[model samples]
Target: MAIPNEALRKVLMEIEQKSIQSSQQIQLVKAQIAAKKRESRILQLTASEVGVLPSGTAVYEGVGKMFIQTPPSDVMLRLEKEGSDLKNDVTNLEKKLHYLETTYTNSRNSFEQILTRAGGSV
Candidate 1:
């Protein structure tokens, strides 16, 4: 079916906007994934370093604005748990990123088809 030029232009603009929004969302998700991976890596390094400490060594854990004395084993446990959680978060974010990328690609393809139908070039 053929659409009037004005209507086609409006539809094209809406599709372009959707594509841009999807692109932005994909970028944001990618950044979040990177940050999560970095955090996970830091946790692993911290755990490894802490592992080398003497068995009776004192460990301090930061809570809010204060550092409280904590057992080395407890600190290691917390780090391990946090690292696991961060890994899960990264996995979820990666799935979201994939979805956003697929949406962005589909929007671009649709936009191109609309332009072609309207005797226009992208």
Candidate 2:
């Protein structure tokens, strides 16, 4: 099937927006992970003050109880893999966004020139 340049341009714009959004999401994930790390540190330090969190309970001092997660040895490995994947995706998306911006800029410039030739055709 054939596609018009305008349609293709719109599609590219959409792709660029999505990539920018994905990059933002990646940043958010990194922030949340940092927050989780801080929370974990707090839990470890306050564990004694909060007193053993009692495996069966969910709340103490207006906060949820903390339970240890016993994941398979590969959990960290998988998380590292996912982090690597996300970083790569963010990088690729940034590159694509740059290309899309350049393409859109060039296309608009070309169209503006065309209009100029037509004497205020725009």
Candidate 3:
């Protein structure tokens, strides 16, 4: 069946809009991954430094809006757990970004094929 010109135009516009949205989402995910990696590195460095601190040294850790005194070992354990969680979040975001890219590519390709069949430029 032949698609009317108006219908084809609407379909193409919707596809373009979705593709743009996906691109933006991918960029946001990339930024999140970068931020997470940076945080993880900072935590690793802090943990290493804390490992060499003298026993019974005072350590203050920030919790939300307040700083609480905590043991160096406890701080190290918290940092390690947070780092692991961030790494896992980054991995999951990467996978989601990959899936979005694939879907966007397929949609764009289909749109292009339809436009070409209709003698359109895009």
What tens-digit string does per-residue lDDT give for candidate 2 at 32-70?
556655655554455443344444454323225664443
Tens-place lDDT digits, model 3, residues 1-122? 67888888889999899889988998998899899889988988999999999979999988899999999988988988998898899899899989989988988998888888988733
How are the candidates ranked when ordered by lDDT, highest leading?
A: 1, 3, 2
lDDT of each: 0.90, 0.52, 0.89
Better of 1 and 3 by TM-score: 1
Record all residue pairs in model 2 with backbone atoms less than 3 Å apart, i.e. clashing.
Answer: none
Which portions of model 3 show Cα errors greater than 4 Å?
64-66
Summing lDDT over every window of 10 consecutive residues in candidate 2, give the lowest-scoring window: 70-79
- Cα-based TM-score, every candidate: 0.92, 0.41, 0.87
Task: Give the CA lDDT, 0 to 100, for residue 45 in model 1.
Answer: 91
Candidate 1 lands at a TM-score of: 0.92
Q: What lDDT is obtained when candidate 1 is compared to the true structure?
A: 0.90
Candidate 3 lDDT score at position 100:
88
lDDT, candidate 3, equals 0.89
